[model samples]
Target: MDRTVVSVLFCFVSYVFQLASTEKNVYNFNGGWETDESKMLARPGICNIDVVDVSKQTFSQKHFEDYYAYVKPVIIKGSTDNTKFRKLCEKTALLERYGDKIVRLSSANTHSYSKRDVELKKYVNEIMKPQTLDTLGNETYYWFGDNDYVEFADLFDQYKAPPYKLPNMHGVYSFGLAAAGTGVPFHFHGPGFGEVIFGRKRWFLYPPEKQPSFNPNKTTLHWLMEEYDNLHQLDKPLECTINEGEIIYFPDRWWHGTLNIDTSVFISTFLG
Candidate 1:
């Protein structure tokens, strides 16, 4: 082959690669899975346990030790001073501050977490999007859980942690960003307090030992679509919507799930 011909082919290949690398995935959700019954239930508003708001109370050491640590959950309103943290999480700040940073996103399909790494700026532009019925919580529905805490340490430092400290326990910080209309399946971990910086997050929770009927392989939306409306009144999970500045203190080992009711930014302090 002539030198000129080889050079042209090389240039074409480089241009193609650059285009592919720079392109982001658009979240064009698939819809049309709603049935009359499903729409009526509207994400299984039935069988829900009431989440009590305790935002006004300042807990003493005894209060946390006796009740919130082991036996029950509580929703604390105005629980955090995150004005600065919320400002950093604004779409533009994140895009500029961490545009080149890699973020790990979990697949909402199954119980075990499967992660995919994406750039912060790319995610806001591409993957983070509104949910639709059919593809709710599926691979395409980008739910940005598992924050890179260390990477955002400065931002996390700006946010306040709940003051109540448990004996032998220390707090670990985590933060996440997600669009409205999606969630994960029921799962549990060490007790922690989760707060919404902005937007609304609806949570469904169950006690630790109860182990409510759920499929590990399915997404939360899958359950809402197929079983939420049909569930007996007695089986409905305890539910609440934590709006801006609201916090939910989840007891250790308690099973819980979340659905973003609005484009949301949130942080959690897990105890160890």
Candidate 2:
């Protein structure tokens, strides 16, 4: 190849590298790329949520009080790791330890879904198989509301809840398991703390003030599993993904839902 051509190619490659580096550092902090602020920042005719890091051992009662009382949703990062919890909740461990235990598994399909009591082993077996149109045809395994704490005592004890104390609220912590492509539909309930122990989940939250924008006909449990893409036309939702080891706290009555990006295990406690 000609020397001139070779030199030109090398210059082009270096220019590309420099451009990439510049883009990465646009809002990077402390050698890490910052989370997308545009979606969470308020602009003309737009509403967004806030993201914060408590990984540096910073927790404030005042901050929690403000968000909780006001019903604002916020993403919290770096509070705890899920290594121990993941190991304990893995398929093999769950089968060997709690396989015989009876728990209720709810199907995610609104049209044909219902809750049924199945042994823990059977539920684990279903999730390990490949997900198919048939597997998710009538319904998919979307685990929630294991109200019996004694049944999951070992698994629950493995999670390390944030050190911050919630004021005068009482609720039960529950375990959730779901395979990739399965998710809970849009709904609202009490205030809660969710810790992801394995895999990641994309969360979409619409504030209570925006509740009227949701379709009244579709709010029922039967129709909620249907995704309403038109919501973005009304308002930009507060979006974030809670990955393994990260914890998220949202106040009561926030319309929130999740999609499992990967097979995941989650622990959540709701406070009213």
* lDDT values for all models: 0.70, 0.62
Top-scoring candidate (lDDT):
1
Q: Which residue pairs in model 2 clash with each other?
A: none
Model 1 C-alpha lDDT per residue in residues 98-205, reported as the tens digit of each score: 888888888775455677888877777888766665563446446355777778777777888877676898988777877666676788989898888766677888
Whole-model lDDT for model 1 versus the true structure?
0.70
lDDT of 1 at 17: 86
Error at 77, model 1, angstroms: 1.2
As for candidate 1, its clashing pairs are 47-236, 49-238, 55-77
TM-score, candidate 1, is: 0.76
Each model's total of backbone clashes = 3, 0
Best candidate, TM-score: 1
Query: Root-mean-square deviation of each candidate, in angstroms?
Result: 16.7, 8.9
Q: Please provide, for model 2 over 12-36, each residue's C-alpha lDDT reduced to its tens digit, 9 standing for 90 to 100.
A: 9999999999865632321121133
Provide the global lDDT of candidate 2 against the true structure.
0.62
